[model samples]
Target: MTESLHIVCPHCHTTNRVRADQLASDPSCGSCKQALFTGHPAALDEAAFDKHISRSQIPVLVDFWAPWCGPCRQMAPAYEQACAQLEPRVRLVKVDTEAVPNLGARYAIRSIPTLALFKNGREVARQAGAMGAADIVRWVQAHSA
Candidate 1:
């Protein structure tokens, strides 16, 4: 049997099982009928964030940021670009720390724009700064299992 990956949909938040090798083919959700990876980062609240981080088989790169933070605003474009580059292999997501302070506290996020890489429900790597698209992609590729 081919290995399968559990991907949570960005549109409907339903878990879809996709063939590991067929990820490049662009799969759609059975429930939502939306493309599994839309080349854009999913904006998730605490509940949605928990579902994604805990259930997804792929690595999840989270941008923990607040709306009022200048560096967070500066890094938005680069993060979105990185999301497009890393999709299908990694699930890129954004969490507005101001709106979801509990999540930031739970994750121990001390900075405004912190990038955390999580796989199999556990964080594996973290970076605290604003980085270019290339740097974000490279960092995720280097650290993600």
Candidate 2:
């Protein structure tokens, strides 16, 4: 039997079962017919955040940030590049603390530009700082490995 993975659709929040080996082939969602991985971080609200973090079989990396934070803005491009390089193996998401204050409070996020890595519905690693794309990739790989 082929192994499968549950991938939450970034566009419609639908859960999809995809063959593990096919993740890099650019799968599409069954419900919305949208590309499952768009090579960019998904912007998530509280509800969507909970769904993806809890339901996805793959590890999730969330960047908790706000619109007005200079460090957050400065790191946006690096984060985007990291997403492109990290997808299929990981799901990268962005939560705007200003829009979803409840999520930030729920996670006890004390700083903007916090990177939290979740696996099996729990946080496994967290970092509070701005990093370049290479550093972001290295840090995530180090933690996830």
Candidate 3:
């Protein structure tokens, strides 16, 4: 049997089961009917963040950042690029620390721009500070299970 993965819909926050091999086929959410991977990081609030991290079968890459931070603003574009490169395989997301302080606190995020990789309902790796698109992609690829 072909392996399958549970991917949370970035649009409606619904979970969908997808065959592993069909990842590249641009799957659509069964519930919301929206494209599963939009080639952009999903901006998740605390509730949505919890649902994705806990339920996603694929890897989850989170950018814990604040709007006022200069480095966080600067890394936005690169994070978008990284999202495009990594998505369908890894669900990339951003959580604004200022807007959702509890998530930041829950994850012990002390920095403005922190990248955390999670798999199987737990964090697997993390890096603090800003990075270029290539570096972000490489770091995630290297660390993700």
| Model 3 lDDT at residue 141 | 90
- Ten residues in sequence with the least summed lDDT for candidate 1: 136-145
- Give the candidate number with the greatest lDDT: 2
C-alpha lDDT score of every prediction, in listed order: 0.94, 0.96, 0.95
Model 3 lDDT per residue over 9-39, tens place: 9999999999999999999999999999999
| Best candidate (score: TM-score) | 2
Report the C-alpha displacement of residue 134, candidate 2, in angstroms: 0.5
lDDT of 3: 0.95
lDDT pick, better of 1 and 2: 2
For model 3, the superposed segments whose C-alpha errors exceed 4 Å read none
Which candidate model has the greater lDDT, 2 or 3? 2
Models 1 onward score TM values of: 0.97, 0.98, 0.98
